[model samples]
Target: MAEPLEIGSLQIRNVSKIFGTFKAVSDVSLNVQKGEFLTLLGPSGSGKTTLLMMLAGFLDVSEGDIALDGASIAGVPAEKRNFGMVFQGYALFPHMNVRDNIGYALSVRNRAVAEIEACVDEMLDLVQLQQFADRKPGQLSGGQQQRVALARALCFAPPVLLLDEPLGALDKKLRVEVQEQLKVIHRRIGTTFIYVTHDQEEALSMSDRIVIMRDGAIEQVGTPKELYERPKNKFTASFLGKSNFIHHNDKVYALRPEKIDLIVGVDHQDARMNGTVSSITYFGSMQRVIVDTKEGQKIEIDIDVWRNANEVKLGDAVDLLWADEAAVELQMG
Candidate 1:
């Protein structure tokens, strides 16, 4: 009859939401394990937000039910669910100082003053915002304010944390920095995190598992390596990571740029894919070579250009070689 510090099995079964004729989410189901970082990944308008809203109890499911730890929470209210949620914008209280902002949720429940102070202090330290505890949201940097917002969400010790593009507003460098901090915090707390993001790099970096969604349905779900190496289809291959899909009659192989290597005269050795180098772009760290193969095939290969890759040039002949096992043959219409 006691709740585990973190009870994180969320089973969303056959959930759907419709805005008249169009279905925002259609009969989607997912199982999130205890203390796991799961990302709901998709482009905009792909029903990820709708699904999250349903889980948060902000939006009702037009059908089906949601259960946490084996109990159905179909009609439960948001406040009762006690979920820690952060949106794209750092939704901090503009009027409150950082300390008060971090303590807001606990205050709403009228937790004891001393307990609130201790929890708030712990959260501020968790997010490294202890020095800025007295500053208002407007005075702190975007990253700092988001950190405070994250602290606030966790201050309540919610069972699960929901992040909807939580790092979307920060600049690139700050985003990367905060992502590191977030991973550390997640490890320290060991809570279930359901993060939603369209950033492929972010998803690949932060999540313990990724759920790729398309057209109100799940395209694929797996760890980063699994998704990248064994994408079920061309769409998932291209969506989760950089992939050059070799269109085949019965199957499709999603090959990554790094998997390609140049063999000056080995085309005939392995299937013989003859191609003319259409363009070569020298990226300081790598070179991207686009080859137009015989039979109108467009193949892209990324070669490390530190010094060796400078050897490649446009209009040059190249024989590409990859192990027969490297190619991920796929079938797509």
Candidate 2:
């Protein structure tokens, strides 16, 4: 069996990347804890990928420094950094079988033949690809091929693993399956994983903490629950999940769809709004009801499908109620 890897932490300080005239990434500083699964999440051109490339040493930092375990690696080359990388494209050798591809890193380092074989076996087991060890990339499915790519990058026991949307090529169902597997592998290996993806669900479900970037700067960095429940700004609230912004009494507040209750009459003392049902959308597990308020505001509420299937419909009058604490105030941007 292979020994456990020594997990490492990262410190990104005032990092910026400029291309002649345009600044791709601006003054971003972050600290990643040891063994934490940190994900950089945002839409295209948000600079998430650009920041990852700098951390991997593939791109130079226009200004600022990056440190691993308290040591500066700003001058280190990509190969000498000893960080494993997995990209969207599998990039596996077409002619090489699973075992050879996984063992290639060790073989090139001139490790003992027996040592290489043992490490390869461990990697195959780590990714649950033991049965397909002899299959070539062309013979395996897309998901299996991606797993092989993961094994190859991890075989040498790099302290940190950098992934660049590794599941982007897989189908929805297959992508979810691989995500669960990746989390299991990370737990067992205890390696610090810095994953990059634009999928909000992916970041919310798998990451220990998420860094939401916009334009070229950091918008917010917090755990999934923290960011979802209490967002600091309009961008963070709307980007992380669906939010209904309420403009009342010269103040702005954000409320989640699920937090609002729909009732036939406005009898309670809590915050309430009266509106006519505008539309209803069926999503299998829950129903989304859009209400057009008398004040000319459209609010969305999510109700359980089984409980509220026939309780309300389009053109029906309803009251939306919620506790005062459920409405989170946001700083005006």
Worst 10 residues of 2 by lDDT: 263-272
Candidate 1: segments with Cα more than 4 A from true spot: 1-4, 265-268, 307-309
lDDT of 1 at 329: 78
lDDT by residue (tens digit), candidate 2, 123-163: 99889899999999999999999999999999998888999
Candidate 1, poorest ten consecutive residues by summed lDDT: 263-272
lDDT of 1 by residue, 1-333 (tens): 013464878998999998899999998988999889999999998899889999999998899889998899889999899889987798898999999998999899999999999999988878888889999999988898889889988988887899989999999999999999999988888889999999999999998999999889998899988988888887788888788877666667888988888644334566447677888877778888898887788888888776463676677777877787788877564
Off by over 4 Å in 2: 266-271
Candidate 1 Cα deviation (angstroms), residue 23: 0.5
* Best by the lDDT measure: 2
